[model samples]
Target chain A: MTDATLTRPAFRRGVPPQLIGLGALVAFFLTVELLIQIGVINRFIVPPPSDVIGSFGRVIVEEDVFGRFLLTLSECLIAGVLLTVVGVGGGVLMHRYRLLQQACETWVAAMASAPIVLMYPLFLVIFGRSMWTMIMMGFVAALPPVILKTLEGLSGTRKVLVNVGRSFNLTPSQQFWKILFPAALPTIFVGIRLGLIFALINIVGVEFLINFGGLGQLINELAERYDLPGTYAAICFVILVSILFFMTLEKIERWLRPFD
Target chain B: MLTPANPTTQAAADDAILVVDNIVVRFETPEGPIVAVDDVSLKVKPGEFLSVIGPSGCGKSTLFNVVGGLLSDHQGTVNVAGETISGPHQSIGMVFQEESTFPWRTVTDNVAFPLELTGMPKAQRIERARHFIALVGLDGFENRYPGELSGGMRQRVSLARTLASEPKILLMDEPFAALDEQTRLLLGDKVLQIQQALKQTTLLITHNITEAVQMSDRIVVMTYRPGKVKRIVDIDLPRPRTSEIVGSEAFGRYVAQIWADLREEASRGMRDEEKHTLEHHKGGAS
Candidate 1:
């Protein structure tokens, strides 16, 4: 019985949606390239797909885009980590204290829809147009969703599970650790993913606006220099970075919740 | 003010493992304060298997919850082994109707959770959990999470987890209601065997008459909304009961008797539901 129950099927699992999506993306690019080659579409405005693909090597070598890529990656990493810590911590605090939740919940929701990016000038004055300014902007823009998701997850734990904990005479802290936290984990991770997305947008946008550092700055430079294909290649690299972030988040979520 | 048939009931039984005395639970809803359990009382003898069978919304579950310490703000006291319970007591374990097995944890870990709360050593807790897991016949699937298991298997895991706590009294709130009839009966047999072996006092809240007759030493029948204990019927059937025993003539008689008692209350509940639906539709039309 033990062996039969424990052994999963030997065959590999079904194909992932990401693989299918990649297939569709390649097909789309091929169609666009064909249209441009046949002169059915103007190449000046939307560069030929082949030219953009060919410019990847030049973007890496001549443009030295890797350093700028590293800069944007670092900003995103710092912002992402801070957003997670502050958002999850604040969420737990609000959930634990009713008064705090009631007072700040509305503000948090409003902040989520607020035009936080428009306050970049204010942040610039406070932090002096440095990477800190960009990081802080990203952090503020990304925080609300994480806090709200964590609150929802922790509060939404099933009453039956909590009752089970109570019946066993678990202390509040013990109940949180054993029952509430683990159950809330999937939702909390969802918040983190959403926060990372907002952080990535603000980080790249700020870099472009300030003409400071990272892939966003490179894209701005390439566009201004009429290096259209190079601009597209750099933009593609930014998309790759987003994909990597999401893929890593997905792997982490799976590792943390293998059963789910 | 419907009085329980066994009104000569002892408030404090010397051999009683659990005594619920005149528990009245009321909830303040938008409509007003609704009485759920109205002055209901009962006692379970040590190692006795007792079932509370009732019509829908009859407060059998409310009574069960009060006993389980999941609900407070009630009017009366619940004593377990002569001690009053103001809050959740470690000696009392509850199994819920809904699937309550911790999905994030493996079967072994879920069983070992209560043990872990008491700060038991890791190896010893696992060893103890393994005993109950095997008792429920889930030895090999110890490492599998609850999500990977079937509904019946998950409920078995819940049963194992509750039993592993070794509570003096187990309160089961329609724990097998979600399963099919066949699985319910099979699990009922497993429960009877476990209760016989362990001799733990059990209070089961169920709507199934057959289950009440097959597993319980005594059955407490309850009325509809604002629930009151309608009767307490003793099961004179032979013990060492199993699913096979449910087919016996005596078992059928006990089930028939309880069904007869419940038929009126069930009809009333259904009528009330229909009236409410009609009223809601009228309100919508207006």
Candidate 2:
């Protein structure tokens, strides 16, 4: 029995989804390039990949893109941490008290559907087109997803598992820490993914609206000056951020999901 | 219903280690109170492998929960080691059908969970966890996370974790129901061997007739919803049992007897569910 169970090899051959996504991405870029090369689409409207890459290099050398990139990444990281803590904490509390959950139902519904972009004008007035406004906007925009996901996770906790925990003489604290936390992790990660994507979009959107110092701000400056190649280059950087954020979260989910 | 008030009942007579008297569990629903376990009672002797076999929604799991003190809204009294069960008592351990192994923790940490809850020192908990790990034949995989293990191995870790607590009574709610046939059979024998070695008082809930006959000293057959005990059939087969006994004439007899009792109960359950569906449909239409 042991030998039969153990003999199966890992890394079985198949076309995995990650490879498929990469293929599709490359195909998209190629098509866009073909369109531009054939003069079907104006180069000014959608800059060619070569122009974007060249403009990206110039920005890296002149604008010290690393410094600005670090600032934006730091804002996202800090905001992500804050949103996770607050959202999960609130979810736990609300799960314990159904009344609090009920009270937040309407607000959560409103936040889910409401345009997060509307928050930029108010943030601009308060923080006056600064990094704080960008950070705070990211925090607020990301908070809803985290909260909703966590609540859904907690709500879905198995009754049998909870009873099993109790039967084993686990304290309430132990129950939450051991069973509740792990059981809720997959959904919580999903929430984190959504929150990260939203926060990235909001940070960039707010940067454009308020003229803050980030890739979004750079995109606005390039567009105002009609530097389409530079605009596309900055947009590529934003896309990279989104892809990296999503891939990192996908990695985490795989790490947390049960094996075999 | 096994209510304690019926003093003359043969089922109530015993020098049993655990006695559950007249348990009636109700769930508060939007419509009204729905009774799950209706006045069910039983006696459990020490070092006995008892199986509670019932159809779906027969409240067997609910009974196990009440006995384990995991359910609080029961009308009857349950005593473990002569003390009334108010909440989870330290003397009762549990295993459920679904994997409750924390994916974040390694197998050793998962097994050590109950010990950690009791504030046992880390070294002692690890030691005990390892002991049970070996007991469940999962020695080398201590450092592996629950996610890294197969379904059978994960359930073994859960069993190890429960056994590590060294509770006087172990409550298992269809713990192997999720596994495939081969894994279930293997684990069934493994669990029996371990239980015999340890002389643990086990109350297993399952629907598999053959499994109940193979592992149990006594099998309690329950009726349909608002479940009550239909009968308790005691098996006197010689111990140091093996899978071969499952095909034996005596084991077949036990299976036949239990099936005979279950047939009526199953028909009643189907009728009840049909009635419930009709009412639900009517309410929806209204």
Top candidate (lDDT) = 1
lDDT of 2 by residue, A164-202 (tens): 677777677877877888788888888888888888888
Residue-level lDDT tens digits of model 2 in B1-286: 2222232345334767678888899888887877778887778888878888998889988887788777787798988878888988888888888887877788999899888887899999999899999999998999998878999999999999899889899889888898987788888889999999999999999998888888988788888877887777777688988767887888888888889888888888888889989999999999
Judge candidate 1 at residue B265 and give its lDDT: 95
Go through the candidates in order and give each one's C-alpha lDDT. Answer: 0.89, 0.82
Q: Write the per-residue lDDT of candidate 1 for residues B127-222, one digit (tens) a residue.
A: 999999999989899999999999989999999999988999989999999999999999999999999999978999999998888899888899
Clashing pairs in 2: A259-B147
Best by DockQ: 1
Q: What's every prediction's RMSD, in angstroms?
A: 4.6, 4.9
What does candidate 2 score on TM?
A: 0.87
Candidate 1 docks with a DockQ of 0.80
Span of ten consecutive residues with least summed lDDT in model 2 chain B: B1-10
In model 1, pairs of residues that clash are none
Model 2 ranges with Cα > 4 A deviation: A1-27, A243-260, B1-14, B26-35, B148-150, B180-183, B275-286
Error of 1 at A215 (Å): 0.9
